[model samples]
Target: MKRFFQSIISSNSVALRTRGLLLLSLLLITTTFNASATCVRKDFSDSGGDLYGTSLRLGNINLTSDDLQPVGTVLATSVVNLFPSVGLTNPDTVMFECDLADANNIYQAFATNGDSNVGGFTNFGDNYFQTFFRYTALKLTNVESGVEFTRIWQKVPITHYATVGNKIQIRGRDFSPIRAELIKTDKYDPTPATNSFGCPGPSAIGYTGNYTCPQPNGYVAFSGPGVELEELGHDANLDWTSWGLVRYYALGMNLGPVSTLTNNNTCGVVSTTPLVTFAKISPAELTAGGNRTGSFNVQIKCQDGVESGVQHGQTSIAIQTSMPAYVAAQKINLVNGSGGVSYLLSDGYGTDSSVATGVGIRLEDSKGVTRYFTGWAPCDSTCASSDNSGWYPVLSNADSVGESGGYTTYESTYTAILEAIPGQTPKAGKVDATAYVLVKVQ
Candidate 1:
């Protein structure tokens, strides 16, 4: 007997698709997929079957910017609301979706390089990669099929992100009614966008638009007909007379191996790295004060703890365009960068110094401000802690590094300048300067 649709077949393949032999009974879809799963998922036609297990993450994800917001702001949801696990035998299967397995760097931050599981996704604010980066993933809405899933407030070192969805299946094979399993709860269990798929912030305050946000990491809302995770499988064809509640992002996952950057060439080591010396000048005191000033004090101390899924407190001190072209032709950026006001300096530091003409050593930060030799100064959260647009921030409580393990320190006081290099004249012999600081961490 074992009758569950008893057995079946039918197809035409490709129009968008309508191929037959839908599922259930590969020994009950390999005991509902759990073969060492940690998100990613497989087993539609069985890439070797069984492998489905997710973890929404209850710890670790304190990257901070006050959890930045305002895009659609509902950053981290999914503590529960998984459906489809009833007296199974193929109940039209549904639930479980994830996205951004790596997305590939643009400057990719949060948990270093990103996504060992749920730590990424971003075209970021907009050069129009399409502006993604919302709740790192998990956007479903299947309370009997109203279909929804969205994101908000949670820019982190996160983990777990579903969209195409699965994990509570009833799969293929059907003959309709033979059902009767009431009281899945005592009563009034509305399923939330009223229960089964809710992330409507203010802790789901009674369906629809209920707003209020300042973001300490709290916000969520989802309307309807949504589905834009692009790739990462789970609409395993049930067609139940008209594609059950409809599904399409093209079908079953693709675009894997986004990148973690491998192959023995390695990098990342800080037990101690210091070098900030500048206090001596002449050549008529640099064009007789056309601009001559010097200041130095950059000391960083870390005794332990800061590697393992990376993302310790904070660290973002940009500007290091692989210098050495005689300190990259006297690096300068229109007035402290893109906001321009005219700025340039730092030209001499190993690789055999030779270009120290017309004076250049303009690096500032000690309230002297001025810094930005490259990109990043608009991700949001009010530019985080601005040094000068492009970024020169060092933060992580207990004074820097926060919690990875043991002691931490961040001291920086560097200023050397006089601004104004239109026609040139601070020339001399040896006023050595070499500035390079990229350092990014979550």
Candidate 2:
């Protein structure tokens, strides 16, 4: 069973920096003065004295008495929030609990109740389903900049566990009072003499204080007994005995057990692939003096229609060609020992112009509405046309690529009609081209 865990891990490794330009527009100053006496100029280089003039010609230009002030407001500053406001997309609140996977086999690997399936006690490590206490990967994006910052959390601890008779069980419960280490923040001081809650600052990022934040900065350090949750492979699945539900603030330095990224049993299914082999395409005989036509089918299957549990559960598939056109030889490369043959792809089923459409690719939904794969207009109910290319949906269960859907898998076949341009001499070598397909779920 390939879990979506790795799929997200691969996607999360990518850094999402939301570039924002907070321009502070300044107020322009314009002043006018009235004159009552004849103007006289004074050069400070020669003498320093008062000039008897309504408007004084101070070498470069004229300046009225109103234009000069002995003292003026020198500087003004205002507080600006550098980091954009970020939090859970679904819930507006700051606290929420994450549920671990319900699969029995996964829990049994670490459950210590001595169940027959119990392999032994093991702490959830990186790549483990329960890593970060199975918290839903929170998507924190800056709406204005359109860049998603880091997923809200990198790690968490198993807050509670219990035993049912001879079998051990892991229950999903509220792991409240949990806080992340504050790396960089513009809120209060990095080293506060006394926190807004009247609590003193801790020595390190994960230390605990007596009082809760009067106003949360959206993150806190993991300052609690959960530090033991980061131990290496667990020796025993002890019940939640001494660890009472006493809510306190503490920062855990080391994540117990969940050390090192493990790559075990994390492969997913190849949902999309070429349906047919283009092994030995018939050579385009230039001497024969006619264009050649052929077709291949690409299988686009959404094995899992939508992501489950997560707030944003939509999935989409995007497609793009590696090269604009196919070539062979020094220009046109060969495939294995096969002779070179230049080709172009088109969406039409019958006779068509490969040049006019520019390797056209089309996608037909379940309703059979065909959309050009080259690009799409950006809009909701009404789409406004533009020249933007790429990042558009080729296949999706949702209306847009970013939307969410329920648990469902969709499948479709897109036909790629290959054409060998006429009147061009074909090079005698293998012919190959590349296309990239990506699947994204939100």
Candidate 3:
């Protein structure tokens, strides 16, 4: 009886273990089915009535984002080493490609001076400033009978005011932006008008619907006064290089793609180099108990590409002398010579000047406004009483400056006078001093 009971118990245990394993396998299968149900691949679905998969499309341009920027968008440093002057061509060329898939699409090309007037680097008016754009080649490769065309423009006058950097805030003193139409033309007229906006208008030679102009004997009407035939139209012909140029000014511009092909119309925000250099410094010969006058100029080249926010008003220039003639307790020490001589330098030269004599130095702007230097001063309220002097600011707190083409220069004239104090005799040697001028943009 014990042997029979042991055999039945072992068989029952084995049967229970087998049942548990089967349940676990069913649970795993159910879980997997539930998970797969949540995410179905519709790409291969039969719900469309067709067992075959749907068509897939993946289109991409040949150029990268960075490469497209220079061709289309404007940046803060959007400087193009283009046109040296009116009627001249840009030294650099910008190249871009178009997909045949994008054929028949209209595109716009533009450039703005970023100012009110259509000014170039030389500040010439928009009437003279021109921008030339053309394609080296145009090929529609997808088609078996691929269409090939080229419309080359030597120069297209830019009329619109545009900027690549921060927008200009000043009124009237703004730049106009120019826009040229990139029209996919029919071979009927390969070359477009100067400002062509695509054809089949009320003025086009072939007045028909849907850009289809039926010209007699394939004669394409040219734009302008008087009727002129420019080209012969052909069937299934594609012209990608036809463009029209127009100009206008604006206080600001919306930064985005100007055409389907380009990302943005602002790029090449190149800075022309903001610089200040000592143009001319006059040497001085002083006489004992007499005054010596000299002048120096600091040239500032604020190029056309300077940010609109960086106007002349925001520029600061400071002038300081090397304390060529130092005096302590009525004893003057010459910078290049020995012995204490009583001497002083002043921005004031004439008797009517407000800058006190014996003051360190007076700096002036182009407007004749003056400020006292603290380099070596004790003469005026603007001057420092102590020997620890500071640089004199040429522009006043209330002053605002303007910019011009090429370069703007600031001149500071000073007088070095030797005044003999009590028990101090004038020295007979060369009186020399060094001055430094600094410019800052706020």
Arranged by lDDT with the best first, the candidates are 1, 3, 2
Candidate closest to the true structure, highest TM-score: 2
lDDT of 1 by residue, 9-28 (tens): 45335522432222335545
lDDT of each: 0.27, 0.22, 0.23
- Minimal lDDT window, size 10, model 3: 52-61
Q: If scored against the real structure, what TM-score would every candidate get? A: 0.22, 0.23, 0.20
List residue ranges in candidate 1 displaced over 4 A. Answer: 1-289, 296-303, 307-316, 319-361, 364-405, 410-413, 422-442
- Taking all chains together, the TM-score of candidate 3 against the true structure is 0.20
Q: Name the candidate, 1 or 2, with the larger TM-score value.
A: 2
Ranked by TM-score, the better of candidates 1 and 3 is 1
Question: lDDT per residue, candidate 2, 1-442, as tens digits?
Answer: 0011222222232322211111111111111111221111111111000111011000000111111101111110011111111211111222212223311211101111110011111112221111111110111122223222221222233334443344323321222221111111111223321111222321233322211211111111122211222212322122312112211111111111111111111111134555433433334433354333333333332333323221112333434333223211113331112111223233221223232221222334344543333211111111111112222242432322221232122344444433343433433333334554433221
Residues 382-437, candidate 3, lDDT per residue (tens digit)?
A: 11112122223323322223444432323333333223332333333232334444
